[model samples]
Target chain A: MRIAVIQFPGTNCEHETLVAVRDAGMDGEIFRWNRPEQELSEFDGYIVPGGFSYQDRLRAGVIASKEPVMATLKEEAAEGKPVIGICNGFQILVESGMLPGSGEIDLALAQNVMVKGGRIVRRGYYCGWTTLRHESLPRRSCGSFLLDGGALLQMPIAHAEGNLVTAKEGLIQELADEDQVIFRYCNSSGTAVDEFPVNVNGSTENIAGICNPEGNVLGMMPHPERAIFSWQLPPPGRRPPGPGPGRMVFESMRRFIEVSR
Target chain B: MRINLRIWLKIPDAEAATVKNTLVRRMGFEGVIDDVRRERLYSIEADVGNPWRLVKHIVRELVNENKEECLVSIDELDLDDGYVPVKVGLHIEDGEAISAKNRLVRRLGLSAVKRVERSNIWKLYIRSDEREAVAEEIARKLLINPNKDSYEILRARARAVGMRQ
Candidate 1:
């Protein structure tokens, strides 16, 4: 399968994403945001990677969400093509109203607000390893290849505004009921928790990632592509032998493409 | 017509204390800077002929009415037919502002100081009189984020050829 990694100016993770896709035994290439719409149709999957697009002006992903490329991405997503957004790319997806299947912005990845030393603090930007647990819903998720639901996966997250919020109260519950909730921050035992620094960014419901209702689009703050190799793990000695936890995500994406074909 | 635009956080102290404390504690500069409050401001100076119409469009497209408050004022520049300048200030919520102020005042030892307001300023210049549409488009598309901040049109007035004489 061939994968297209979308690159917006200031997006720094496209190369990593491409490498991950190639490591998974799939053909991968970079697709600039200004490229013609026809070029996107040739790829079987797309990935919007991380970084401060448009210098993250106004708000993270706000300007990039209005870019011309998103129109085509939205169309492809509607056709059941897999699209994954990571970190700032996730912000763009939410800003563009692609996640949760609403096509309207119902949620926001707000500034990271956490409790430190008994008081609320804006952690500004955070970078470190985190544990994630997949949601255990009967419905299939876009990225669920190598691991079962509730399995603990260690990943890295680097961002300033990653907290998830919704202006309308009680909407998070609706997302859960719809089986759109995907990965969540959890303890080592794989128990999802609402406390920090586990739920590092204080995302609503400790959400680390989510997929659209139809399961073709996924948006998450953690950088799974950054952890594909066992050597990338924190404290090299702690890494288990063989592939890293992040490899499963790409492996799953590759499997998803193969199955779809 | 000329217009000045200002965009800011809805709460005056939204950016206060947060950065100063971090700078003082994390960066090891406890006493170097006595106090600091960060604010964001957007200034739009346009030579568009239709000030009111432009203001209406800008308010609807650029400002977030639900999260922020905006005010419009008229400018009286001495020059005739000169562009009206619009100033927009962004602020956060009232309670958050007060709490931030209290934290800064107590921690920074600023009893003698009256007020500390910090903001960011963005200036937009419209050079063409006939291309008011371009100016309006810029304001609507690039000026602000409707999610958490608000803006105010501080002043707007039409420039007349007679005023130049």
Candidate 2:
């Protein structure tokens, strides 16, 4: 399938995302979403890469969502084309209104385990670019993939505002009711955490990603692009990162496009 | 992961309101409901990241040197009300924290305490008025000679408690 990766000024991970897509052996090109008349029809799907768009000044992805590219993508996504928003990309999708509106998710401010311990630990992680050793990340990330339910994925995260928030009601049921939630944050043992560390980002029901009403658009905080290699899987001494179910998310989308032809 | 004491204070006053506002702005919390009540009551209420450091900073601001004589006047009021301005203890979850935390507890002659991971927070707890003494102790340890910085921290801490409001 022909895929286009949106390239914005602060989007640093577009190239890596492109690498993952290309390595998967699909026709993929990096497109600077700002260029005029950037036709969405030129590609079958679009991938929004992650990074500190507009410096995350007024909340993550708040600015980039207003971009011309998002405006176009949102329209096309509504018509049934696939769009994937990752990290900052996910934030952009939410801001752009491509995904279901969060209205107001009560956020809980907390710190990364790394910050508390004064160094990075292999066990616990949250957003940003870092080498992830996962046998289970794929599973965590994909467990909620496009499923439209609030859940948690043991996915790696690296953002300062990675905390999850909900407004009005319990965000889990709301998202699940719409089938808008796509991923959740769970512990390594495939269960959710209790209180303190549940869904590291504090996402309700451990949700890590969510989808639009149509389920054609997915926004997630984890980096599935980082998991393109098998060697990166967790070590043998560790129970092994387990099967990366999230990979199938991309693979399935690619297949979905292929079957349409 | 490793700590001696920690705490998470839900400040209730204007002093805390100012600091809370500053923090919200600094943290870049956008679309927040602007107001001391809404701003102070941030939507993203989560566990305290570093309870000890958090309290220590608050103590520093509370004890910071400032001309806002009300804090000292409060002491006089305490005396007039028949209460000695002795120090109070602030239970901490982590012992090894910013000097401000240790300084406040030690300086005020307040006992330092700890809790196991099962507790998930600081082991010590201090009464209302004693917050000043513990905060002053933290400032002294930092060698902020004038005690101005210490009082600022204390004011900031008490503000959250609604005491300095």
Q: Which candidate tops DockQ?
A: 1
Candidate 2 DockQ category? incorrect
The CA lDDT of each predicted structure is: 0.67, 0.47
Question: What is the C-alpha lDDT profile of model 2 across A191-234, one tens digit per residue?
Answer: 55533344454444555667665566777777777665544444
What TM-score does candidate 2 get on C-alpha atoms? 0.53
**A109-199 per-residue lDDT for model 1 (tens digits):** 8777665465565456889899998785523666654567677889999998888877656778987887677788888887766767877
Cα lDDT for residue A185, candidate 2:
57
> Each candidate: how many clashes?
37, 89
